[model samples]
Target: MSEQALSRDRVIRTLPLTHWNQPHHDSGALASLEQGNVLFLPHLSFTLMPEELKLLDPALVAPKRKNITFDPQHNRVRGLARQQYAQQVTDLLSRYYQHCLQLIDALLPEYRHAVHSPSNTLRLHPVSTWRSKSSWRKDDSRLHVDAFPSRPIHGERILRIFNNINPHGENREWRVGEPFPVLAQRFMPHLSGYSPLSSWFQQRIGMTKSLRSRYDHMMLQLHDAMKADRKYQEQGPQVTLSLPPGSSWICFADQTPHAAMSGQFMLEQTFLLPVSAMLNPQNSPLAVLEKLMQQPLL
Candidate 1:
């Protein structure tokens, strides 16, 4: 493989999340993360690579669909848990985690205990796909933060780890469409047990109208402008990432907006891992691991 490809492969092996001790706030790569970008890390020499990517595949990592409560309203969905996938991805993640702990230890040695026993959970999103030659605009999925109002305040810090299994560049490019304004207008009020159309009277009409009318107006304009630009192309239905096999990304769920594109001959799978402050605990073997990461033995 070319050096560039080799470098990419090395990065896949050494995920920043699993390897680095703590984020180098002073480094350009780590600083970008404060602005909601990922800090990619190269794999450690001792880390083991999965013989087959399928071992860490979302379908295999998670359990078969089971009825479970999701959403703030306790809405139900059938799916697997993070621990289920952890078993499959554990060795791979352990390598990355070890490195991450070291960084964290160096920066916050006093709080190392908290980093060890972090309350971690995993939830997987159902994989959806579209084939090639499909219309991209009509299929445009809007961009929005992943947070829900119903989740606990701390839950807001949760990072949703997305793993893409499709071969690189096989699917069309996925784009993050323009953000929508008037959040209420974008969602049907009736779905929330409020109906602007069926008001007690016209007294509330002005308020509802003001909020709902502006929905997606700005985004629609931006979309049109983009299409008019000479750079517009009928892209496929997939977002391409140069992630190596067994590699994953830690993204601030509520901060980043993501979506897949539309196109033909596309196959993609996704898994969600929830990383929280509670992963490390006050007293646990994991805590010991967290402390070890902080101190470098000379």
Candidate 2:
């Protein structure tokens, strides 16, 4: 028998801030997210501390879309300290990076088990965005899933936490499409076989940060195929959510088809969750691919 399809109501849910930090894990909610669902948290309010508000002023920060990352490793702040990237502005924005991390950890379960202990690597992406008109890969205008050639996930899920922290009452607009399984079934036939040698060559020549695995190739193929298809990019099933400033949302980006239409000044946090921890592992890309290919994928 064919498996049951996920519904719109079951996929997207809105809940209050109180539901976030409960003692026990919400298995239903967790299942929804693991299976390409999105949590529309309009009531999740993140009020910046007075100091944070002053330091992270949108007017003061640099307008470069490619330079939104605020991790200490990125050194955007150090550049600020050295009178580069407008020292006064970048310094102010850097101060709030830690606070963004703390907020996401408190709000999501991707990092914690039912016992309330940390379970996964919470890779907080201190990305404050500004919409760009660059090439399709660099641009956020097209509908696509999140995948990086260098960051081969090896079947792990890409969970994301986003905050529409737009100042001046602006909203961060997004067009989120349906679940991944539907799209995968439609496009799987078109993707070419993954090449291990080619991937190794790319890593050796510094084309990728690391050796691209089969999972990486599959994700990259899915991303490119979906974006390149004009019909899917334009007429695909989707819903618009104009998230206001102070609101937050969470989703498994790797399994969800999405497009950023407009609006900016947003904070994004990324977390990696294991397929084994999922409420329904069969629903993940790793399991789905294994079923489709009639072999283990990861």
Q: Which candidate leads the pack in lDDT?
A: 2
Q: Compared with the true structure, what per-residue lDDT tens digits does model 2 show for residues 156-210? A: 8777777665656877767777678778888899888988899889989988877
Model 1 spans > 4 angstroms off: 1-19, 22-31, 40-142, 160-250, 260-298
Candidate 2 regions off by >4 Å? 1-10, 18-25, 50-65, 72-110, 113-132
Q: Estimate every model's Cα lDDT from 0 to 1.
A: 0.32, 0.63
Model 2, residue 32: C-alpha shift (Å) = 1.3
As a whole number from 0 to 100, the lDDT of residue 179 in candidate 1 is 17
List clashing residue pairs in candidate 2.
none
User: Per-residue CA lDDT of candidate 1, range 34-100, in tens?
Assistant: 2344333323222334563444234432343311222211222223354444344444444334544
